[model samples]
Target: MSEINPSQITFARVRRRLTKAQLAKELGVTSRSIQNYETGSSAPDSETLAKMAKLLNFPQQFFCIEESMPVIGEHAASFRSLSKMSDAMKNCALSAGAIAFHINDWIEERFNLPQADLPDLSDLPPEEAAATLRRMWGLGSAPIPNMIQLLESKGIRVFSLAEEAREVDAFCTWHGSKPFVFLNTMKSAERSRFDAAHELGHLVRDVYSMRHGETRGIEMEREADAFAGAFLMPSESVVANKPPAFTIKYLLKLKHYWGVSLAALAYRFNALGQVTEWGYRNLCIEIAKAGYRTNEPEPMEREVSQLLNKVLDALQAQKVGRAEIARGLCISVDEINALTFKLTRLSVVPADSSIDLVSRRSPGLRLV
Candidate 1:
């Protein structure tokens, strides 16, 4: 029989946001014993192991699986607000990334997903890079109808951030050649779209290629925000359709056109010099007074992942449901659901639906 992998214990603990001391207390063991078990110097007894599985909400087989887990360190990911996130929050997010790696691999084995087509724009300024990428993708200053679909179409793996990691908006990281973006679906729809575009900025600008945590610096955050503004609301489009005045109502009317928040649209115009400094300050004051900062007016519906939706639908056609996937991966179904919450909506595939369950190339799932 295979021995339990010690690292899996560490992963489960981190995923549950529990410290070694906490877990040891829950399992009725000493902290040193937990440390020893995690370091492979000792193994948890059967009773202790069962308690661990129960406490951590992981399947017993998860501790025995020999598969290697993906590593995502603090230096590797480009987080939006790194200074505000605690180590526990960051570890919880990274743990989700690790689980996503396994789920992505499982999906890829059954379907030919789109390959990465993002460019490296580290040499250019944020706005110029956004323009260049738009031209490269042939998106010619048009409003992106669906940011999630656009990202998935370009081979970026999109996932939802669990509520435990909600303190930070979103983050992106590169696992080998595959780029993954995790969004906090709890945010407003417009904010979520901006978050997706902001992560794309980090990816294309080579923020993850930095030497260390420099990717989380304030300047880098500004660059990513600038990139997101320019990418989502192109200068040409915003200029041609500039509102009559800088009134909050006028700005609110145009925000839906670009699928961004009213404040974002106001800031964009101000950046372009369309609104004077005083005018911009007044706009900000009005936005805050109207509570637009906290609550978006006329919010749109949250965007779901097209790639994951299609993959899950196709997988279900072959009798592979959430429970089966969880069992195969030695993970609990709740963990899987948490990773894909609001991003994947499981639907029944009609008997007459034209889906090729045996073939890997199922129409829209082919490589680009």
Candidate 2:
């Protein structure tokens, strides 16, 4: 350990949000001395370090001691927001970080790896394009069990985008050959699942296009939607079940069957000549009037993403105590309680247990 220099004292003082004059008033020293201290023209004595620590409420060692810090990077708060996130919330979006970090690492590792020659989808017919993807991925069946997990295990990054990206429900970006898909999490699981399928469509079909997120031509969106519908529900199954006109009841039945929005299946019905274009439009208007667009009429099914499940398993595998994890990850005390609360629902910790844990503060948290 070394003596406290003026810079260290001044840095800590500013971080504590104390001004030079204010610190001087508290320390009973002149403002000039504080300024000189910050400029490294002067230093605080050991006794003064104690006083500063008492004021700042940070470990005295925080001044010069170094420790390994976790990588807390930011992601787009939303597709619309320009500002990046702060270093905080790395723990909150643990699954996102874990998968994204691995995906990014894989790209860096394979930067020089030759991209496997993919089909030139630009010239292929839409059916051929879809078929090409089907062959490439070997998705030989009708109904995908859980779409999110399916894409993630294939090296695609899927995040449920925030509510603001409702209009723009999903997107795809490629780091080399790997696709990063963001599904709007704020949406229903049905929609999120479809969005994942749709983004996969974009990744498979539109990989050659230089423009990524900002490229919003009708052609691209249409192709992706087609891909989503066919990929999730498949073409022949839909065609096999065609009706003259799709009613609200019919659409509702399939919503549970395929986990897709009513409007999406309605369009499919119209496209397959199950209903006239006018009938399809009227059905949508009727559904909107009934508030089916805003809320599920029946109880919606819940699906915990595989990504979140993996994180839970990882924690349990490490045998980390809840409180230790909370503090180590810089999360709220309540977060640990809430996570452990499920398993420890009936298990109660005494009031003293809380005090015992809190008393053992992080080294950075101690003032002295």
Candidate 3:
């Protein structure tokens, strides 16, 4: 009975990663028509609205919801490979961020989540900033067992990047005072951990620097990369535990110890002058030859959200299943799962059919 909200058309389209022309073709209409529908100059009739909802995989009521879609502007977010990513990829990731805001809000309203405890470390160099954070958190050159858990404990909201945004390694942004990180779970577990740390670097450095009129692009990215390397593999630990040789086997052992990719370890070692430039290049070549660049060897288990797990368990205890949550948001259960790290385990019966919940936790996957 509600009138269609034109902006919702755009939100659904972007969330699905479809451009106006592509969606128009699917709907057997002109791109101009789709634009008009999105801009509120005109509205899609019931039939067209139904098709749009179906193609976008959103419920029909979603397009009629009165609430505004939360927007994270391009300038506000720190995206990995921002220059190389297509507009669709960036928008898709940003849309996922909007969904994350909704889910985070829903959780916060009912429970007392951790408050942000991050300090401003923009004035210091990346290594010093990393060390300062380590000292502040009482982590002295020790390897982090779980980056996601640690970040959540510090009141950072972490979510998984859907498969549609796989090209985007990860991204972070501030929604008001709170920080949110989106990690590409499709990547190897080691790479994902680095991504998590990389975003944390942005939270500590880039977010504060931006307020003081600093540019928010590749320069910040370079600094964040350095921070992540130092945060994950402390310089003192790396120097004290320098290997006798930098062979692939030795690199593999170190990779497991540090819980980072081989290339990351190689770069860190080379940066510290332990390996010559020529030696670094050769190590990279050997790593590529072993297909380590594309495929990870001896992967650790993927880290998920401990906070979200607890939240879901609490919700289950209250007899509020995922279906109720999805209905409250006027979205599909699958959409909720996509925004989450896919961690909800209670059985849910969607409007269309039933979905069996199963554990996605990787078993017996230890650092080898």
Pick the TM-score winner.
1
Residues 1-368 of candidate 1 have per-residue lDDT tens digits of 26989999999999889999999899889999999999999999888898899999998889998875777977788887787888999999999988998888877767788989998898889999999999999999889989999999999999988777888789999777899999988899999999999999989996436424453568888999999999999998899988888998788778888999998999999888888999999999999999999999999878888888887877776756777777767888787787788888854433343433445553448522
lDDT of 3 by residue, 91-169 (tens): 9999989888887887676677887899988788999999999999999998999998899888898988877887888
Clashing pairs in 2: 59-366, 160-185, 161-183, 161-184, 161-185
Error of 3 at 207 (Å): 1.8
| Candidate 2, 1-368: lDDT as tens digits | 46544444644454344678999999888999888777767777777766876786434664443322222223222122113422222223332333344333422332221223334465664556766666676877456767766665565544443222233444555544545565555557676677777766666666556233344456766777787777776567777766544788877877677678787788776765668778878998998999978775663454444543443343344443444334433333343332222122222222222223223322211100
Model 3 residue 122 CA deviation (Å) reads: 0.7
Candidate 1, poorest ten consecutive residues by summed lDDT: 348-357
Per-residue error (Å), model 2, residue 233: 2.5
By TM-score, the candidates rank as 1, 3, 2
Task: Flag regions of model 3 displaced more than 4 Å.
Answer: 209-215, 342-368
C-alpha lDDT values of all predictions: 0.85, 0.53, 0.82
Q: Order of candidates by lDDT, top first? A: 1, 3, 2
